[model samples]
Target: MSNITTAPFTYESLSQLTMKEGVLELQVGPAHAGSGHMRILVWVEGDTVVKVDPDIGFVHRGVEKLSEDRLYVKAIPIVERPNLVDTVNANLGYIIALEKLLGLEAPPRAQYIRVITAEISRIISHLYGIAIYGIFMGSSTVFMWALADREPFIDIMEELTGARLTYSHIIPGGVRWDLPKDFGERLEVALKYLEGRVSDYEKIWMNNPVVRARAEGVGILSGAKATELGVVGPNLRASGVKCDVRKCAPYSVYSDFDFDVPTFKEGDSYARLLIRVEEIKQSISILRQALKNIPEGKIIYEDYYKRMTPLMKSIYDEKGRVKFTSLLTSLSPPKGQSFSRVEGGRGEIFFYLISDGTKNPYRFRVVTPSFRNLPYFTHVMPGHKLADVPVIYGSIDYFPPEADRR
Candidate 1:
């Protein structure tokens, strides 16, 4: 048997490994359906996978480095590109870190709006993950259904932020737009529709005997092993670890609402899949609370609100979105460092920012959940069958653009 270490495999070393007897190596694609924008190198003995290495960076965008070159406010959309399905959370994490450095806090109404959009983004991300998993598992029905279900939430976001996917809605002081007059009615309808759809998914997908058999005992990442490997998000929670950034370290207005962090002890592919479903339910609960108790006030911080020119204030009053002043272009923070973490749809999205009293940051670092979860490819796939690769990969919900952004 060949020994595989946690260290990443270089292309040259992998190319030279063909001389080994009894082990066949395979590349599961930068173009494969199951592998999106990345390749997985698999070594198998018969049907059993003996070793696996994930080759990420096919879609690397150098987000951290790019952030250093742009002004603080201009980097919002740049940071959001890595995780298009969960752009709000990515935008929020960066904004929070910038806010900390600037010593700014958004108003109560803005904080509540931030939570509402964030939970909506979480649902969108989870649905995308579930849809991809369905296709991987050969259930085209679930894939279509999950993807179709994301539209209503996307519509709501469009109405609020003027864009569907990469909504640079969250900024340093507050969100870009306030909830629309009819937003509550539309949100309630969407939430109720999703509630019914969740039940359908439970019957057609989650409880399917074939899915259960294929995933229940396969790719078992035990809680201890998951913790040791520094797994985050649903993968970590599925291993029975009660760690969630929202619950453990509340950000925005998360502390104001009540929501449960779903955990499952099984730690198998099935558990990882099931945890996302539960998280969607929790996100729904949070959205309801945020909408119900949202206070009425200026969406941005008072300091920035007061600084808005007469024309900017009138535009905000008429269109319900913030019009940035020239002051934001030259905005600079104190010379210091700050760290911020937010519970994104996948898990914890962390940002470390260093400002040198300049409009652009001195240094910017982001640790995406997908990047943190990459070790699972090496540690968890060793004993599984080669065919089980897609099942485990989908269950982990790894996004290569986000993982490769470093």
Candidate 2:
């Protein structure tokens, strides 16, 4: 390690050094003040990396504080913006946490709706991650194809909720509305289409030599290290850990669905990517199973409406939104804190929600998937060449600044 201050270390000159001493250190900074600009620095002393840093916060929006000011249920759509791709996972985690605190249970059919939306969100979220990974690896065709295929999932969400990205579909007691007529047929078609596209994704990217080269053995995270660092979702599963919330805890109607949590001992970037691909396929199967097992009933919690004020019910009927679900607006509960972890697209989203026998929650905490998976970039990005930084970065599938900087 070189004795240097906070001054910049240019990669242009560092690339000239050739030695068996310590490795190059790569770090990123801002290009301009308030410009949200980014800079990359590297110090190549030898063949081993001694230091690597990722500096973020140029785009910090203070989401936590924003959530604090909003009403209990008002925070749902707001919190989804940071990890917009995994909207349903975010929604599910929040709803489950509230359910634990408020002592509420969604109907079986409503749980099935949640399952369907969550799986669809998983498909789109994986699509976004893979496409971004493809772009980071300089494959525009793969990126375009992956993004284009994500459109069908988005269409499904739009029809179900009248919103493309922010569904606000899940509530404290239950979901907003029941499945539309022919929902089963339409979803089956979408699944068939997704099944074929996933095959093509493997052909062009997963199996491609260049993509595999960039991913395999790039960011090798062992099972022990993954558990120690608290990695979750596909990244942790890649390390051969079969600990899935659905399997271990079996929230909602997950116990009724049949699926496998894919894992690998290699724990490399390629393994993580493959885990997601397999997960998407698995989610489709779960959706099929859920559709088959779905029961007939009210989508929203039956009595939540009866408890609401007449004005609230009138608004609910007029707007067709579940924001006014009684369990949402005037939630008072036993004083306690509960945690709920759900498998998100990036990883597990864990929530710590506290209730104090009042309409407002005493405290709320969320640990997003990217936050837990950021260790890969900080600890694993070094030892690799500058050109491979984006590859490893994408494989981890982080939302950059949003992942860390906490």
Candidate 3:
């Protein structure tokens, strides 16, 4: 037998190969079809995606670093910028951390309000994810319906918080506003509409044969692997992992509300899609419960309330609103480090704060679910077809801005 030496694998050797029979590279861009600015380098071999390398970090704003420069309360809106769709939960986690540092707990009504807004934010985020997922899977109807349904929720949010997307409503002491007088009525109507629309979604998208063929068994991430990779949110739950920050560690008023933490055993793209639907239903249930059970009390804690000026207190009493004071611009919590976690629409989000008894936090760190779940991309993309890239992407719901924050 003749001695034959194998050629070394290198960039030059790969470049020399023909594009037709050999692997071809396709760049999905800075203006990628989905939400954030992210590039995906796909290496294809005969319509099969043999390897996928997710190129991110184009939207990094150094949110964590910036938080150190701003006062504790001012950082809320700064952190909110990274994940505009999931605003309430993102703000909630950081506020909870600040509250821990100051040894403050929001009142019962404030807790309920936080729960309602956070859950609403969760629904909004999930709808956005599902809409993108539907479009990626080649179903325009699904996208249209999801977006159309999403508008009512956004309207409700605007009425409640005065801003549609980036509402820094949750503060260290309590929420910024109380439930609007007609908020429950409007919410009930929207919930009714959503209840009907979810069934329509099941018929038009989830149960559709074409969608099933494309999404089912595609991009499977097993529980063991998901755990090993430290994935969170619906992605981890879809992988048969029963982990949700809401259920595992009850924060805000989530422990009081009765709602199921939806999970799936399939751990595939279809499962991820279905889990969002279930989560929406559960969120609606929580919303209804929160509306019914919300107590009539001060939105802010007495400690914060007492310190407000007469005019500010009057505004809060009359309109259920408050303004940021000069004191808030220079908060000095006792020297200590505290961390808080919340179950966002995507998954578990964490905020760690270090206070040296100063106006600004000495150190601030965030662990968003998208950042934690990113590894799922490279882990599951290898054995899938090139056509399945968008499906896998939409299912994971990776938000690059949130993930890339320093």
Give the worst 10-residue stretch by lDDT in candidate 1: 1-10
- Candidate 1, residue 406: how far the Cα is off, in Å: 2.5
Which residue pairs collide, candidate 3?
233-347
The true-versus-predicted C-alpha distance at residue 378 of model 1, in Å, is 0.3
Tens digits of lDDT, candidate 2, 171-267: 8788886677877898899899989988988887889988776677777777887898888888889888888888988888899887998888888
Following a full C-alpha superposition, what root-mean-square deviation does model 2 have from the true structure? 5.8
Q: Arrange candidates by lDDT, descending.
A: 1, 3, 2
User: Candidates' lDDT values, in order?
Assistant: 0.89, 0.75, 0.86
Q: TM-scores for all candidates?
A: 0.96, 0.86, 0.94
What candidate 2 gets wrong by more than 4 Å, as runs, is: 1-43, 46-49, 308-327, 401-406
lDDT of 3 by residue, 1-406 (tens): 0121212223443344444567888888877664358888777888877666678889888898899999888899999998888999999999999989999888999999999999889999999989889887777888888888989999999998889799999887888888889999999999999999999889988899888888888888889988998999999999999998888899888888788988899888999999999999999999999999999898888888899999998998899996776666777999999999999989989999999998999999998988898776667876677787888888998888888877
In model 3, the Cα lDDT at residue 55 comes to 80
Cα distance off (Å), candidate 1, residue 403: 0.4
For model 1, the stretches where C-alpha displacement exceeds 4 angstroms are 1-17
Residue pairs with clashing backbones, model 2: 23-48, 23-49
